[model samples]
Target: MKLSPRMQFLVRNGLKGFLWLTVLLAAYFLFREVVITHKPDAWVERFYARPMIIYLIYCFSEFFFGLIPPELFMIWAINKGDTWHYLFNLSLFAGISYLMGYINFLIGGFFYKNETFTNLKRRLLKDSASQVKKYGIFLIIVAALTPLPWSGVSLLVGSAGYPSKRFLKYALFRLLRFAVYGYIVYQTHQI
Candidate 1:
């Protein structure tokens, strides 16, 4: 039997999802070069002197569709400053990254609105709306902490028009997640 339109769309989206995952993995391998070379000091000298631009770029990267290696450039920034400055820089990076999560959320929401996706949600997310309303904040925090790809969640929130106040609160928690993970990485790597 021939696949229906919905089935075809699902197949296409599944392929797209696989492609996206491959791209993310390949990007990480590409970044391994920079990590291996270890140009931390040079970057420190460059960005530490001009943090504003760096921060803006960081935010822009996270806001757009950029894969974060968590430390491609952040390590340099951290070591370039005083301890507090390091923390501040890390926090700034996290804040921008968390905001970018909203971009992801929007994308997911858009996909959710698609004819195929809408049908999928109607069938799968039978209680998603009510559950979202009740425990959205908790879910956001969990997604943020775990490497569950939060941008999609953010996109869903954006598309659903989830309350802005709650979104922001959830976003702050997401930002804090960066700090938490970064500190762990920094300590473990001693970088």
Candidate 2:
């Protein structure tokens, strides 16, 4: 059976996310094995020692088009070797990301009619805006669940004057993405 265009888009993006994760894990393991003569625990400790700094960087990255892949943070959390700590970190990461997206949405709405903001939105989200117009909530769902720019999509939705209530409801899927991806990263770390 032929898939609809929306399904195709989703499938393509899903594969991209999977491949990206695979490559990231492989590179990390290779570096660990070949370059790090010392126990990774030392390195992990050095970074984990500054939890607040890591979280601040993550919050910035999530707000600005997710500049960093969250899976890396998950690996850092897993390295602590404490299940509760890992879970707590993952929850914090997800919460921070969700909050950033909501903030971007409000920013978009607040600047809805500003010419400068509109120009910037058109330039940054040219294709995404069209996709948002075409796919409506489905595109938001895809962005939330996949590696698509979650903040950008949220901005587009808000600037387009989509209902805030519905956006919040759909954006909750961001948590599921974190849960699933965090679980995968944790399991791989075990291996």
lDDT of 1 by residue, 1-191 (tens): 89865555445554654565467556755764666348856655666788677667766656654445445445655566666766777776776677678667766666656788778777888787665656566556655655445665676665554776678776776666677667754674453
Model 1 misplacement above 4 A: 1-57, 102-135, 189-191
Q: Per-candidate TM vs. native?
A: 0.55, 0.80
Clashes of each: 6, 0
- Candidate 2 local Cα displacement, residue 85, angstroms: 1.4
Q: Which has the greatest TM-score?
A: 2
TM-score of 1: 0.55
* RMSD for each of the candidates: 9.1, 3.0
Looking at candidate 1, what is the lDDT of residue 125?
80
In model 2, the runs with Cα more than 4 Å from the true position are: 35-42, 115-130
- Best of the candidates, lDDT: 2
